[model samples]
Target: MSELSPYEIAFLSGGPTRVAQTALLALYESDRIRVSRGTHRVEVLPREPEDLHPVQAAVIDQVPGTGRLLGAVLEAVAAAPEVRAVADALVSGGLLRAGLRGALRPTGEGKALRRGFETSPGEGDVLRLAALGPEGVQDAKMREILSTDDPKPVKMPKKPKGGHRDLDSSGLSDTQYSAGL
Candidate 1:
């Protein structure tokens, strides 16, 4: 296989969300976007570079003119079609397994690619690696952004298995129940 691009490496490493984050970080590193340290607000700059990766452009599109919270922007861009296209390409290229909904398993080639990249990362791999997690990031602010910007969905606590005792059909548990009135 030909040498894979950093974006592709990111997809292999952590799927579409990583691709979105790589694009976002690339935009920030390139000065295409501005991030507010105080509020974690992300805004696209007026100056548009003629050449931008599809995911990068999509990330910019995800942001509003008034800017948006960093976490929300990351979530929006991760779900964008452009990011999905990267996954599709990987699947078609025999990297990622097809038909997996929740957790995408990588094919042999994908695993080897990830392993190779991890073992001997090139200079270009820095941003993509950083996008995977905060460990690879050097800048304190960027690391903070990487570590805190993406918010995971909260898992709601499960309801009690037997249902509420207060609403039991026997009526003994009911508030108005009078045992021997």
Candidate 2:
């Protein structure tokens, strides 16, 4: 198998959110997106015609909410509240492409990563992994497994048999007989 790129690795571990988060982090690291030391917002700049992956280019175009810190932006976009907007922005920006039957398809390295986090197991796993990265997922799984305590089934006691000596042309005994019953 071919070695996974950082984007691919990020995708396999989680999903589109992780992929976008990884892209943003990469862009920031490369100085394509700059964050001030004391500021929460990041600055997105237009590219200057250089060799770049489509995802990077997409993110460069879709500069998102400018209120939170650099790290907070990634986390929030990767998680609740802003995640939906971020995802829509990613799709529009071309960082994300819809797949067969509207599944999350890889644009570049995302295809090569070869992940089914959205399908295999279930969508819940994909969302879970997305919400809690790889380490967090493992920790949660371990906690779940460890939290469960199995116990042997207890056998129910059988009732005493043969209270009636005989039946009066009926299969039922005296205990079963009643007025018009």
Q: Model 2 compared with the native: what TM-score?
A: 0.37
| 104-125: candidate 1 lDDT, tens digit per residue | 6789888887887667665643
State the lDDT of candidate 2 residue by residue for 1-181, as single tens digits. 2433444445545565575555665565566776443333567755577876555555555556453344444544445433444446545544467889986554664443334433332333323334344333343532242123323334444445945433344444565456555
Q: Judged by lDDT against the true structure, how good is candidate 1?
A: 0.74
Best of the candidates, lDDT: 1
Per-candidate clashes come to 0, 2
Cand. 1 TM to true fold: 0.74
lDDT of 2: 0.49
Steric clash pairs (candidate 1): none
